[model samples]
Target: MNSSAFRPRLLAAAVSLCFAAPAIHAEEADVAQAGQALASISVTGARFDAEPSLAPVGAIIISADEIRRAGANDVNAAIRKVGGVYGRQSLDGSPDFGLDLRGFGTNSSQNLVIVLDGVRLSENELSNAVLSTIPIDTVERIEITRGGASVLYGGGATGGVINIVTRRPQANSRSASMFVEGGQFNAGEVRLSGAQAWDNFAADATLGTQRTDNYRDNNEFKQTHFSGGAQWFASQFDRVGFRYEGARQEMQFAGALKEAQFTAYPRQTLTPNDYGSLDSDRLTVFGQRRLYGHDIAADLSYRKKTVESTYFYDGVPSPATYDSKQWQFSPRVRKLGAIKGMVNELVAGVDLTKWERTTASGFSAADAEQKSKALYLRDELRFDPAHEGRISAGVRREIFDKDYADPLTFAAYDAKQALNAWELQASYMPVANVTVFGKLGQSFRVATSEEDSYTPLFNKPLAAQQSHDAELGLSYASATQKITARLFRHNLTNEIFFDPTANFGWGANTNLDPSRRQGFELDAEHRINAAWAVNAHYQHVQAKFRDGVNDGKEMVLVPKNTLSARVAWTGASQTADVGVQWTDKQRYGADFANDCAGQMPSYTTLDARYARTFGQWEWAVSGQNLADKNYFSQAFGCKAGIYPSNGRQLKLSARYSF
Candidate 1:
């Protein structure tokens, strides 16, 4: 069926399912209880402790077991299996994969927000988040909130929000684990982790090292990671903790290949001598306390990073170095009370951050700095005792002061921007195990330091990107099954992006014409029996220029259709899983005119894993791209910029507990 016809049918099916719940032969009391239980499951995506059902949009929560069953090597690998999300290999040949949501394509990194334990991981520059630095073993759960979330997360959250909660030491417990793995492409890894807890003190630490010679020449990578934390429980309702994390990474860049070169020799590298190295460290101190029916929390963190790279351009080696530092502090309070005989919740917070970067190149040096402050408030009201009917509203105001200086040219410029975001949401349960939710919000993004420095008008600051976001959805959850269907749209103005054809083909960062992204997403999971389970996700999105020269033209790299499915089995002490994903054809990157010679081809991939547990030891084998399918999900130019995807890969791993 055509897209126009399919959308309505799918929507109808979702609504019909909500009404048909009563017809199912199940205990109404049990279903109602299950529904309530699901509604009360706490989530941190809202920057406060709240139930997932109270959120304006659909959310996906991935547990640690799911990540393990996927046999993912990193956080990005695990996130790709989720619906309405796509992951692309990093251009720098690092493990930091690019995750795209809502078809933002080339600008996906700038549109999405990533939070780790209540700290923002998304950088203020053009680079993607360093997902590789986070060890998968440390992850307790991942919460994904779909659609704009600028009200609580500040800027650069126009696409969605992903919160990664790490594991913590448990009271009166002591455990240690060691893991070793070897895989194709000369990949190998070793990790050791341990935790100890006493009556009032807890401590945990992790150490890891990895090395890989990737599929392409000049793509060797080596990394080492270390993290440790200590906590002191002052009382039953108060605690303070401190954490330190550090990493060192070295990698070689293979560079992009042309269409012809990719077909002839996909593994060959034109820039064989290009190489880069990075050193990063972060320290965080956090505290939480409960007093007078209110919960208060705060976090302070400092991070330092240094990177150096050498690129051989036309056989002339050019070396550069970058140094950056960031400091952030956030404090918040949440209270639950009764208002007019109904339950009410209020959350208020403040965020303060300062960041600076210095870049030194062969011939010049530059410095950039940004200071930001924000205050936000969110409140929710529940109409019924079970929280079956609820309404929430939130607003945030943020101010940014940015400065740039070119030391060699004695040039300096400063700019300041103030942005605001607001959202209103409501959810109602019309029947047992069924809920309908809707939301309308405003989100905005300011120009990054790099984007401002390279504007078309010389040092002039670009306009803040803004979007009007809205979504509606229905969800049904029971003991054995869960399903959700959502329809969302974002109408944007002054979207910030690089336009290669702008400024007389000089190529510069600028605001684009009006654009819109509208889509439908469906996610479902079922437990067929004790030993069998299945899940599936489907998304259909239309991202296009709504006006100007590229009117009605599809955005580059934005696919219209994507689907994924997985089957899992467990019996005795053995577990097995298989999954498949398919992506539809899309316009090549930089093909804003939608007149490229050919679209990026559609492709499907298969992955599988099998594992067995033997007392305190576990062993597993996993494979990705089992079919050896060759496809590229990222390109910078029409038919020219190509990054070849990896071929078939296999790995074996063993873990021992003590």
Candidate 2:
């Protein structure tokens, strides 16, 4: 018991389960068994809404049965149960997994924006979104849209967006499944999945492989993944679908540890022959139609990625390679009528992109090209329908063209940018279950092309990174309980970061003048009967730097309180789950220096799962962290440290279906 005294009794039992969630109130057939004990619904910031707590902001849905009841092995462990989402993986999880929303620190993949199944899986030269290239067994849900979606997914969304839906085909379902696991240090995994249908057509597939031999010491890892999909209906409302995914990975980078080598060898390895490698491919196609009253959709995608790395500064190695190709197109239309007396719904969209990249080694060789386009519109208004009110507005116009070349000697770097964004939302329910919302937004990001041709050599004057976002929300749902609360704020201006005093840590990509991030969030769910249930989330953020010389410091790994809780039980067919998380203590070097010295402490973790079934066979056991916690999820140098977060993980699994 010491984690500073068991972390205030686990943050006072997660604030007493958020005030006992309105003192549980079941009925309506116990609310579908309490919404299956936490998860589902919430279609990410509305649009043909699926009720994300009556959208207007704040959303988090992670189904696929909550990723198999949180045995989650990707999407950063199922997006850390929402709260204020945070994730950073290393020390064995291999080069990937880094996310932070609503307070983008360390450039969280250039401020969110990750979608799949609707294409657009980021990466304009490291605007990452490689959650192991989809394979939480082909996720079937994963909304998560908290704020500022850049007027419908465009340009690094400025802290929001994470679609990722997968799994299709229904008609007359057919199934197949397989999973296997092994744990403790020399980990292991295997997965195979299937689905099928006939007549109107359908299909699905998944395959996976994972390996680990990590606990430091040249952190080992290897991975492989693949996904497939197909669908067609062609009638009724017409539809079509297609998907494919692939991945290959390799790792070995053990490079951070200092603080007396993390109290003497926290799995040692401060650059054990640094390494990295990745390969990827993706394809997507989508279609939908329903003319007349409108409801059209279209999507197309293609992607390719390749990366190689070798680093070791003082020890000299420095290898580099990155190859990329991408193409995306999106089309949208939706409509609902009656405007004179209120009642309206309209959505419009157009986004297209083309990208190419190359960054060779043996000294230098570069080529980059990018093109983007965007046009967006949204409208939603309803005045009355029994205690109701709604209004939404959106606008977007984006344009970019960036190029960087140097095929031997024709050195160049060109850029052009155009941006416009807007969003305004309002909602009210007055009763009939409660809802209240507000939002105002704007987002932008630019200055890529490898940060303008190989990150400065004497060049400076790169701009584009703007944000202004706001949110206010409230929600309550009856029939067993659900709650949401929010208050968010963001104000960024020319805030591009990565400057460890110019270039010591591969930094240099600087800009920071105004910065601010305000926050308060809470999410709750309850059902204390029908086999127990509970859920909780909390966040309190304040990230800063609102002027000159580190105006108010803070904001470097942004974390000022975050908590999560979960509990579930079923019985008849057997199930059990438990969860806990807390993070608070962060600061690890940011521009405008905050007296440096680096810090990152504050951690708590626990996860559990149990499953049982027989008819079609299923069995499970899971554990992660579970009090074997001694954390430090991230930190970098200038003497900061390096990766070390992963301890106490156990696994056992079996599954079968036909």
Tell me the alpha-carbon RMSD of every candidate.
9.0, 24.1
Q: Write the per-residue lDDT of candidate 2 for residues 221-305, one digit (tens) a residue.
A: 8888888878788653467878888888787766556567766767877667866767787788888776754667788888887
**Candidate 1 per-residue C-alpha lDDT over 1-658 given as tens digits, one digit per residue, 9 for 90 to 100:** 2322222222222111111000123354543453344345356635654565454356788888888887876788778874336777676666676788888887788899999888888867777788787878888888888888998899989889988888755689998899999999999999999889998899999899999888889989999999899999875447899999899988887777778888898888877887778888999999888776566889999999888877675789877777889999999887655554555667889999999988788744879899999999988777775538988899999999999998786667898999999999888888898989998999999887767876788778899999999999999999999999999999999999877666665556789999999999888999999999999988899999999999999888888998999998988988998999899999877677877789988999999999999999989999989999888887766775677777888999998989
Candidate 1 regions exceeding 4 Å error are 1-42, 50-57, 82-84, 234-237, 409-411
Clashes of 2: 2
- Quality of model 2 by C-alpha lDDT: 0.70
Residue pairs clashing, model 1: none
Computed on alpha carbons, the lDDT of every model, listed in order, comes to: 0.80, 0.70
Alpha-carbon TM-score of each model against the true structure: 0.92, 0.33
TM-score of 1: 0.92
Give the best candidate by TM-score.
1
